[model samples]
Target: MSETADSLIEVLREQCLIQGQNGIKGLSVVFRAMDIDYSKRIVYEELKIALEKFGLLMSENYLRTLFNALDLNDSGGIDFCEFMHKLRPSLKQCRIDVINEAFEKLDVNKDEAIMIDDLQVIYSTNAKQHPKFISGEWTEEQVLRNFLDSIDTPGNPDGKVTREEFMNYYAGVSVTVDDDSYFDLMMRACYGLPIRGS
Candidate 1:
């Protein structure tokens, strides 16, 4: 990465880190704004304009360099997961492992996507008792679908929670938590996974 790109990333990282979870949330909004085509990814042209909107005006060369750096997969565009992970504070290996464990539990079929069927089998009973379901605002299936929609990528709630989507959701939560052990416990409790060293 060039010095300019590195410096830009550092500036954005510091800006986002201070806001914590809201920082991630705000970035999500900005990402959607940049994704004018609703492809859920920002192409070079979109990135260029978005940066200018944020007053980070850069020469074409600088923008290209920074875009390349952010596009880790060289997919020629930046997806929300890649964009978020780049700017958000990284989690420890232990934190990531526990998160993966929770995802595996939810991914009952091991299909890499947590669809409604997997959720029905895994969460149906508990979901029925949810306040919305009990209050008659939503059906049991609606409750499950709502949960999946929350975790799905913005504007692309295809009723499938990909691992990347799951990771991104937790990544937002992880930002507000500073203690690894607390995060681990939260994940275990929320997912109904066995506690470690129990």
Candidate 2:
């Protein structure tokens, strides 16, 4: 296998392990029932497709539901506070993109934009709310703390998570996202649904 493919597999496996899905023997049992081969990428594609069938992509109902919740004034266009308020997530994605945008906004250093040190205690603040991952559970909090440490560092000597650096390592900037849509990456990955195409 190519190194890239192996890397992806390793990351996927680690994510499963970290998320408590790794040792979920029930996962194997369930896969067996579905006649799925866990070692196969096609299986992941199949699973992802199945999840899409269950609503991975945003339905009109989902958008309207979330939109109504955010439109506090009942007027079109989400205001600054309302935008931040509606941006929070009940669940956490082990990835970093939403936070990346937040960093872009808070990036005081125009030189490198946002650095890891720029982000601390990512709970609800007056300016922003993190929706992808709730700062919940002991390990989850640890993950946040570790993530902060991972990204924060001096520019030249220590070197931290610069906006560019963060995008390269964790955030996928090359993947142009859709604006009129409301869908999660986890759903996309698990279901192999192209954000734009299908």
Candidate 3:
């Protein structure tokens, strides 16, 4: 069998082992239906069509972005191995870790705090181009104000967000895995799924 076929069979076997017979059966049906060419690999176009057929309408750019993320090997397609791996539940926690890492990078001074100046620079330089901030939905001023409000403490008159405060706010807004709401949003962005209100 070809590598693609072997990959498909292996993924199915693993899913069955992890998700049990019914789980694997359902996934098998979906994969078989999606493998329209019987090549055992899901090309970009096929995945796009399948998503659309499944009523998961997504922008072309978003679709391309999502495809790139899932195509770990840059092989120009997604095999069952890639699909199942990306769909793992632990991805939610992984996303949370990524957010925390980004926060640390933004903290800069190693002071365990994020100052308004730090936020200001990020807002001025990158907020405009950021997917969540673009479209004029959130002005830089609004973001700064919100950040300060969320992190400011009565004793900290200097208006800095402590690392703990920053992490708390970040988790509340973007990282909480409960209900997987934030994770779903991230996944949508990754796959080019439409974000509500944006």
**Candidate that scores best on TM-score:** 1
lDDT of 2 by residue, 1-198 (tens): 345434433443333334332222222223234334433122333433432443334445543444445446766533323422232212234234444444555454555644333433332241133333444433433444455444332111133445643433232221223331343454344223345455
Superposed on all Cα atoms, model 3 deviates from the true structure by an RMSD in Å of 19.4
Selected candidate, larger lDDT, 1 vs 2? 1
- Candidates ranked, most accurate by TM-score first: 1, 3, 2
Task: Give the Å error, residue 165, model 3.
Answer: 40
User: Compared with the true structure, what per-residue lDDT tens digits does model 1 show for residues 42-88?
Assistant: 99998887766654677788778878989988999998778877776
Comparing 1 and 3 on TM-score, the stronger one: 1
Q: Which residues of candidate 3, in runs, are more than 4 Å off?
A: 1-28, 91-198
Q: If ranked by lDDT, best first, what sequence of candidates would result?
A: 1, 3, 2
**Residue 67 C-alpha lDDT in model 2:** 42
Q: Score every model by TM-score.
A: 0.82, 0.24, 0.33
Q: How big is the RMSD of model 2?
A: 20.1
RMSD in Å for all candidates: 2.9, 20.1, 19.4
C-alpha lDDT of all candidate models, in order: 0.81, 0.37, 0.56
Query: Candidate 2: where is the Cα deviation over 4 Å?
Result: 1-100, 121-145, 149-159, 170-180, 183-198
